[model samples]
Target: MSSTRLLVIQPSRTNPPAALAEWLRDAGAELDVVLASEQPLPASLDGYAGVVCLGGEMSALDDLRHPWLASVRKLLAEAVTRNVPTLAICLGAQLLAAATGGVVRPMEDGPEVGGRLVAKRDSVGTDPLFADLPWTPDVLQFHSDEISSLPAGAQLLASSPRCQNQAFLVGTCAYGVQFHIETTTETVLEWAAADPEAAERAPRGGFTRDGLDQLHEDLAETWKPFAQRFVRLAEEGPRPNGSLGRNLPLV
Candidate 1:
């Protein structure tokens, strides 16, 4: 049998898949990355085992400025409707929420930047992708806008004091996370330099080279296995009962 092929939609040049691409490939899935800013999104999800939409520098509502986002949103909606295993990160998460009737707006408290922890909700006890995560897993936050409300029928899976809609599940297999589990230190530093205001909002000492190195180390511990589990889910596909197969081992 061929390896599982996942469609990775990159909404921004700055926020490439980075470490997430390595994790997915390490988990044995073949990736086809579509830089949405430079190319068209696939009209259908056909022949793709899963979809992974990465974060972007733009707001989810910036369709006029970045028209390709409209196509990305459409594909995401179709992913949910078809029950394809999907993971949407950061701005991608906001887009997922917006595309599915949830609301997105500028965070009133200001941008959430740097490495932080988000507590897992009880609903994750049975979620195929989140059940195995640590109680309060380490994550990287660097977004100005927030998913103020989740899409109807979406299951809230994780949250933090700063952002309520940190992670959520749509339908059976679509997952959206408001944090960054995929950034390398270099990727974040570049972001910081480009958006100094947002970088300044980061918690004091959050952007040091040592700090970022340790942050990625912590992320690899928690999210690398999570990525593998996602690849397994993609490989297994949806079950006859219209569910993503088997809950992840909770231990």
Candidate 2:
């Protein structure tokens, strides 16, 4: 059998797939990373078994500043329409929501930064990508925007106190998470250095070396298998009629 082919989209230079690329590769998927800021995005999802859109520093609505964002949103929409397994992270998740009839805006409470926990919703029990995750999974939160409302028919999977749309599933295969499961401690420190104000909003000791180290360890323990399961889902291809044989309620 051949390795699964996944398209990884990096919307900003500041944020790359980083550890998530390694995790996906370890799960037997071949990644084709597109730096959307520097490269042209594919016009279609053909030949790709899955899609992984990484985080970025830019706002999902900043098309004037970053024209390529429009293309990225189109690509995400196409991925969902075709039932291609997709995992959109952070800014990518915001773009996915915005492209799919959902709303994205500056977070009302403020930027949610630091290592945190998001409780899995009951619907996640039937989700292929999130079903096995612990009740509350550790994740890195570094975004200033939130998915205020999900796309119609989108299934809520996990949520945090500050942000309700922590994770969601669109259609049968597209998944989006508002947190970072792909960052290394170094990656987040770079984000912090660039945005001191947001960094300040993190919980006490959240960015300390000890704290971040433990957080990444916990993330690996919980999200690595989730990534692997995503690979398996991609390998299995879309299910019949795009249904998993369970009723996932819409939000």
Give TM per candidate.
0.94, 0.94
> Which residue pairs collide, candidate 2?
none
lDDT of 2: 0.87
lDDT per prediction?
0.88, 0.87
Best lDDT goes to which candidate? Answer: 1
Off by over 4 Å in 1: 239-251
For model 2, what is the alpha-carbon lDDT of residue 4?
99
lDDT of 1 by residue, 96-206 (tens): 888777899999988999888899999888777888888999999999999998877788999999899999987788899999999999999999889888887777944
Worst 10 residues of 2 by lDDT: 242-251
